[model samples]
Target: MLDYHIHTTLCGHASGSMEEYIEFALTQPLREIGFSDHLPMIKWAHPEYAMPFEKLLEYVQRVLALRQTYPQLPIKLGIEADYYSPAEEAATRSLLAQHPFDYVYGSVHFVEDWAIDDPHNLDQWERVGVDTVYELYFAQLQKAARSGLFDIVTHTDLPKKFGHRPTKDFSALIETTIRSYKDAGMVVEINTSGLRKPVKEMYPAIEILKLLKKYEIPLVFGSDAHAPDQVGRDFAQARQMAQACGFTEIAVFEQRKIVDTYPL
Candidate 1:
């Protein structure tokens, strides 16, 4: 198995060193793990959410150094980039070009200037209304898929992080977004971190996973770990979830492309 959404302390919010994360992965059943710490913030910046733009090169070099230190395990250098909007997509593209990232996760943590996933921005949910929040979220997700700036989409239904459910059916929006992802040749990651959140379920929920399976979109796994101890956390459930979704394989990435796949 591959738990490819690990984060380090440099991301500002996460704790522990990069080596500590790698050491923890060594004890897991994972054949490979990726250090996908949050990339530098842009547009409406969140200093506490992501690493500083100046640490960009340092983060890459640190991951490269770990590959040498832990040659027995394949540790891929990855980044979790935020897709704020299409207007800021060019900045993201330029940032990605600076490194030879194994896989780039395009996630939408913000809708407009409000950080939907942030605890500080929780009130925005009520102000913007639940249905609109979900609607705007899927809109941005569709745009992210069409922007051609990411290899995989992480935490597809992140608006539910605080357990906020929509009143209306979003099947059409979600299906359209899934089609955009398929058309863009993108992979969708079943992030396990959502189980730790108030939602008490994996990202995208089972319904979205079924839609991905229906659209024949590829699947990948991510723990979205913020600390070293959280590496490969709850992977048994993740595997079961993938199996239930009819995903027989999990995609593996290299140099921003799916080079191969492994059993789910």
Candidate 2:
């Protein structure tokens, strides 16, 4: 198994060092592990959300050192970047170009200015209405896919973070997003963090996964770990889900490209 969405303490909200995660992976049955810490944001500097811009080089150096030390393990350096709008896309691209990441996980954690995924503002879910929030979330996600900035799209249905379901059918929106992802040659990550969150399920829900399978979009697995122990957590379940979704192969990346795959 390969888990590509790991995080380290440099992201502020996570714990442990990059070496600790690699050490933990060495004990697991993982074929590859990637450290995709939150990319430093020029617009959002909240330490809890990502690493400070000044620590960017330090983060890269640390990961590179670990890759050298753990040659036996296929450790990849990656980043989880947020997509806001077209205006910010150029800056985000420039920041990404500064590093040679194995893969970039694009995600939308905010809609406009509201941090919809933050537990501190869970009340916003109700304020925005489930229908409106899902629309905004998918719209931003489509834009992210079209931006050609990410190797994998992380947490496809994160707007349901609070377990609030849209009152109306969103099949069209979901299909459009999946089609856009396929059109852009992006992979989708079945992130397991949702299982540990209020949603209590894997991201990109079963229905969404079915659509991904229908479109033949390559799938990947991410534990979305914030700590050492969470590395590869619930990956067996994620694999089972992928198999059930009709995916026979899962993707692994190197230098921002899917260089190999593992059976589901």
Candidate 3:
């Protein structure tokens, strides 16, 4: 199996060297792995949330060197780029074109200036209202999928990270969100990190998974690991969850495109 959403020390919030994360993956039953540390903050510069602008080359160099260090393992180069407003699309694309990224994960951690997933911003929920936060969060996600700036969409339905649920019915919004992914030929990551969060569930929850299976959008497994031991953190349950949702294969990407797929 493969775990594609691993992070590196370059992203200030994550710990461990790139080598440590890879070494731990080797100990698991993993055949392939990828480093998708948070891309440098664009339109905003937050040192604690992502790597600094100057470290982009450093991040790329380190991951490429690992291929030479461990020729036996298939290590992929990737980045988890946050999805900002549509106005910032051009700037984001210009930054992403600087390197040969195997895959780019389009993620939505912020709704406006406040990060919905950050513990420090928990009070923002009260200010913005939980229901409105959910609506705005999914809207930003739909825009990200349609922008065609990324290969895989990471951690769909992320507002529930702190156990806050929407008071309104968002079935139509959810279906439309998945449709944006389908229309753009995007892959959705079945992120296992949610299980570690207070929600105690996977990202894109079971209901979203069924829609993914129904819509025939491809799948990829991600631990969204911040440290070494988090690699393949909950595969036994994640794979079982995927099979139950009718997913038989997971995608493998290269140079920002899917090269092939691995059986689930």
Candidate 4:
């Protein structure tokens, strides 16, 4: 098994060091583990949530050094980047180009100024209709995929973090989101973190996974672990869900490319 979305303490909200995560992966039956800490935001600075911009180099060098120290374990350095809007595309591209990341996971944690996925903003969900929120989120996700700035889309259905569901069926929206990913030639991560969230289910829900399979979009597994013990957590269940969705292979990346794959 491979976990391509592991985070370290460098991402302020997470605990444990990169080495600690590697040590934990060694205890699991994992073939590869990628360190994908939160990328420093160019427009925002939340030290409590992510590393400062100045620490980017240190974070990369630390992961590179670990690769040498743990030659037996396949460790890939990756980043979880937030996609805000087209206005910031150039800056986002420039920042990402400066680093030689194995993969960049694009995500949308906000819709305009609202932090829809933030726990502190859960009350805001009650102020707006669930369908409206879903529309904004999927729109942002589509834009992120078309931005051509990511190898994988992390936590595809993250807006449901607080378990809010649209009164109307999201079949069309789900299909459109999957189509956007397919059009971009990008992979989607079945992030296991949702299992620990209020939603209590893997991200890119089963229905969405079925649509992804129907479109033949490649899938990848990510624990989205913020701690050592969380590495590879619930991966078996994630894999089982993928298999049920008719996926037999999961993607692996190197130098920002899908270099290989492993069977589910």
| TM-score of each prediction | 0.98, 0.98, 0.99, 0.97
Candidate 2 lDDT score at position 71: 90
Worst 10 residues of 1 by lDDT: 38-47
**Can you write out model 3's per-residue Cα lDDT over 1-264, one digit (the tens) per residue?**
799999988889888888899889989888799999999988788899999999999999989999999998999999999989889999899999989999999999999898999999988999999999999999999999888999999999899999999889999999999999999999999999999999999998999999999999999989999989999999989999999999999899999888899989
Alpha carbon lDDT of each predicted model = 0.90, 0.90, 0.92, 0.89
By lDDT, the candidates rank as: 3, 1, 2, 4
Candidate whose TM-score is highest: 3
Error of 1 at 165 (Å): 0.4
lDDT for residue 78 in candidate 1, whole number 0-100: 92
Model 3 residue 259 CA deviation in Å: 1.0
lDDT of 4: 0.89
196-261 per-residue lDDT for model 1 (tens digits): 999889897899999999988998889999988888999899889879889899899999888999
The TM-score of candidate 1 is: 0.98
Off by over 4 Å in 2: none
lDDT at position 116, candidate 1 = 93
lDDT of each residue in 1-264, candidate 4, tens digit only:
899999888778888878889999999889998988888886777786678888999999999999999999988989999998999889999999998999999989888677787888866787877888899899999999999998899999998888998888888888988899999999999999999999999898898899899999888889999889999999999888899889999888989888898888
